[model samples]
Target: MMSGRGTEAVADAVRRAFVNGMGEPVAVSTRRLSPAEADQLLPPGSEGLTVVVPEDDVLGALLPGITVTGAVVVADETGARLFFTSVPVGGQHELVAAGIRAATAELAAEVSRLRTEAAVVDALHSVGRQLTAQLDIDRIVQDATDAATKATGAAFGAFFYNLVDELGESYTLYTLSGVAREAFAGFPMPRNTDVFAPTFDGQGTVRSGDITADPRFGRNEPYHGMPAGHLPVRSYLAVSVVSPTSGDVLGGFFFGHPGTGRFTERHEYVAEGIAGYAAIALDNARLFDRERHLVGQLSRSMLPVVPEIPGLDIVTRYLPAATGSKIGGDWFDVIRLRSGGTAFVIGDVVGHGVTAATVMGQVRTAIRSYAQLELPPADLLREVSELAGALFDPSFVTCFYAVHEPDGHTLTYGNAGHLPAVLVRPDGAIEEIGEALSQPLGVGSKFAERQTVFEPGTDLLLYTDGLVESRTRDLTLGIRWLLSGLPALREAPDVGAACDELITGLTGGRHDDDIALIHVRHRAGT
Candidate 1:
């Protein structure tokens, strides 16, 4: 006699059997009930298998008997058995009964296998999603560690990134999970050994039930044991994150468990899939870094180094955006004009990266060429604007150009869709010059020139919009902040120190857009 739950369990087992064996859905019932009771409990068109009395009229001999309705009855010394299947057949009854029994046994094993495979697939998909969600290398490694540990049912997991220093020597950064930071604090990073070599070198996957038992485990000299507080590990599985395009190994995923044979072949496959996703993430990060490096180099090369001018102390600074922000097109130059004046220019090309940098280079060259003609500020602005429009077609630029005359004690400057240049007076009063601006260059916009008395013992400051523009603050507020902070900056010993202090005050030393600043202090005596 079986309880109600036991009967349902048997029914589920038989249904699985029917589907796996016959490729069809069939109802099965097992309970301790007579024919009349089973008919009452079972639904119409469903089959019921129940225990029955051998003395019942349907089976006089108390041996196994098959009914026309696909019900089979068998009598053993302990009790009578009944099996109900959907289809009724006219084959050898004993052979059919034997086949059904065999299928039920096979169903149990197949179901277990299917469940394991499904788990592996789900784990792979989960890790893939995590890996693709972001490109930060540290976060990617941490996520990989978590996913690998969970997928393999390991006690601990770690990811190691192979990195090269500026000196071209190789080192690694590690992200760990299922372990204490304190445990690793006192321990040295693991080196390449017989056990870790396969994955580290990209030779193949390594799955070991007991790493210490392997004969070649510690072939390297001085086989120091694991750290004292390190978690015990008997099972080990490692997979290498290898770039498919370059075939270079970027990193490795390593898992460990205290119990031997904790990881299986299925776990290895799941780890492999995780490694593939991580490899892609690493490749993307590398490409982004490479592009930023190249753009930084190009933009820096285009900026003119400050030249020593008589009676003028000039200082310049260029700050690129923080990581993850696009490289911008801000530039500054200090050129000795053919008229024996110092030309100070700051401009921002209206985009980012290689294209913006290229356009900026062209405009700077045009401005320098026009300045060499010793034209007045307004005429120079007009010529450079026209040149930028013709050369950089759709891209526009905002510029402020000024030339300081040493003998005349006057500053001649012009603006084209740019921020105002700030002049700090000797009395700590601030004035904004070049306020009358026109449209930016590359649009054939008109420009105007303005002259102001650049009094002795005063300072001049010119910068791109990046120094005064942010999402939360308008240009007006940024300018106000700069003006309010000028009194304190006027006492700085030199233009270089003043520029550094001004940047720190205005931008807090970090900017979303690139910043270019040119500062000049005029003295009464050279």
Candidate 2:
């Protein structure tokens, strides 16, 4: 393909040369091709021949001594060549050709340098985005290793790092790219050898065109250099990943190729850039893991263990959200009241993370404190709501409080913007209780208590929104699903099994929100 201002003239010149050389008639067609189109067809540094005429005439006008008419520039994979359309009479062409070739070579070298720099910058940006999106340390290192291997044209790459467990014990871990884990399964962790120590110790980057020739090679005991059954490596590069915040070496990236002199200075630069990104990503993941662990411990510590009450069976379950920090505000408690009644409580504060969990703990404690006063369910909820409004700002909470009287035949309850409770009778009839429904706590809505005769052999199920609400199912549909499964609870061996069955059916064993469940059953002979 040909492109430029004088493509038609060049096509004519080519046809004339072809006819004069071959002495035969040949057909030649010309079409306009944009410079952009030509560049697409033939990318930079591509192999092939290209010829063009100088588009600028100011150069010739500035040089008065040489009256240049037309000049053509020819380029190939090797380098570029310049030729004049007409030679001066008795002029030696050899010297001029040599000078033009030297100038073209220098220009080509500069263009190649710029292209390499541009490519490295683009690769670093892409690797940074991939690393930042991952919160898992293993994934971050594997991705960084893969990107560095490709950028450096290495046959294999590995990232070796350190991790600390809960007991404060440090251990080593490694991730490999372009090779399977089995390849290194039989080998022990790399030692602090003369050649490998610099990278692991964070002294400086080590790059070798032929590592075996280095003075540090073969200086260690037991096999001297690479161990037996190791992948061949003549070209090697290593860079330490140092944490920017702590100024400690997190890990090191190593790349290798079997061919001699496969790596260059540019490859070392690219590997270092990827190592920097990997360090930041790994640090963020470690911080997230620590926070998640602390939040989980706090949430578990706040849940109350049910006490053994005569003639009553109580079973409870609490599951945190599946994503993010994996902790939230959902909580459950079974409080033995002063009047010999039992208060079953479940509440969910809005949002998640450490803040939501702390709020939940405070609300749960307040409810337990008020239960000691022997107050009714409605009065108890009113007191908690007033406390919640004063303590929690711009955050709301949903709760349900129910009291089963000492006689085991009277049930009083109050709901504050929470899901309605489900009751299954002895004969398998289902009833949904929502008469005491009101706005959530901190919303300035009054609570009205409701009462029902708690018959023997009856089961009451109370749960947070997570049990029946998800991205795929709305509250209305979720409630319908819950009601459909209630009649079957009677067939369950015990209340605990019934709670598990209901959760499995509604959430399919996977839920995105925090769940709190309280199942209570009154025995027939009580």
Candidate 3:
């Protein structure tokens, strides 16, 4: 009995009832205790009659050597301090005490079950988001494998997928989680056996609590069950990933555990959901890869091969953007004029992808056609700009065109909203010749042409904006860095080595945008 302000009558009635029911002498005692102290007498999930006999001096003074059995804890509005102890054996008190403990244990188990369900739901939501956010096939597959293996409580998991090469040859690849790749290096690719056929054919999910005991486990040839060095597996689960759009089987997720009866219905449901997400992600990645391949090929075919002109050393480099597979509009060309001179051209078209690359091709062809007319730099740009305004949107392209005369001394160039070309004189003097700057093609009516006399051993560099613009450095600072580094090119063994060194030093070999570089060195003895 718990000591409270007005529970004495209730305690006395309960004591009398217990004594009459048991037909034995019973003595009841009351004590005031906090909730924490009372919990120790009857803890959560405690099942059945928990009897504590009295051996202390205080309780023994009232009834010497009393067998204090039939202990019960009752919780009410006040707290859980209503404790009762009887001195009888086998009666109504024992039945009542046992009922309360049994109910508490059941309630505790229910709460734990609900918490586990909520956690699994949350984890599945996170996994779905992670799978849908990626477009890389390798990354998406690996992430899906790792997440599903953790959710299913598997000792190790593997995702076996199919890939088609450029020559249309199909091959199988696998990603592993929770185990080293060397663990399965000696094993051959899984065949469509009795156990694996259902998963690979996308029939349905297969889950076995004890896979070794399953009838479909030992029907394959060569290795009837598992190979000698294979990891021990008693529980197995597998799900096939099928594309939602094409209905094609993309891959299968296989999970295993060394302990028996490790997976459940809930594990099967979660694995199926993960397989759905992986299928969609893999489909998107494969489509993206194909499109990128075609666009890259088209962009590369439009670039020209630098001609080997006598008395002039020319080297050019074109690098696609490093971030994505989208093609850019940066291009460079070296045209040998019929009059024994050389024409150098570099340009950039706005935007990216197929549209930008198409515009670049048109602009490059227009410039080459106008250059063959023997027009001055200004006249050639004017003709190209007029054609751009009629064919494309306003200010869509920026270009720089320079023509070196037959004497290999006079250089005439036109700048149409392009970066200034750097000229390195024989004396190591640097000069930026951008006096003919004008609006980009399709925006300006008149173009300006600038003329300069190049002495022997002079070096000229023309490049697109990608070389002097980046996320970390502005155009001005990048240009300054380029100017400061140009003097070192004088010591380079050849023009090709010098061009490679310049690009590597400026972008640190990891640039995000496309780069088109042209290095023209007037021979020292010419």
TM-score of each model, paired residue for residue:
0.73, 0.79, 0.79
What are the Cα lDDT values of the candidates?
0.74, 0.78, 0.80
Model 3: colliding residue pairs:
1-83
How do the residues 1-526 of candidate 2 rate in per-residue lDDT, one tens digit apiece? 3444343343344333322123443332232333443343333654334444443353354334665434444445444433443222222222333444454456656777787788789879889988978898878988998899888899999999999999999999999888888988999998889988999999999999899999999999898988999999999999999998998999899998988899888888889989999999999998888877887777778779799988888888988765567578898899987778998888899888768878888989999999888888788888988998888876779888889996748889999888888888888888989634888887745898899878889988889889899988998899899888877777778757777888988998768898899888888889
Name the lDDT value of residue 476 in candidate 3: 88
Model 1, 20-43: lDDT tens digits are 244554554433445554443333
Question: What are the C-alpha RMSDs, in order, of all predicted structures?
Answer: 10.0, 8.1, 7.0
Worst 10 contiguous positions by lDDT, candidate 1 = 46-55
**Pick by TM-score: 1 or 2, better one:** 2
Model 2 misplaced regions, further than 4 Å: 1-50, 53-112, 353-355, 471-473, 484-511, 523-525
Q: List the candidate numbers ranked by lDDT, top first.
A: 3, 2, 1
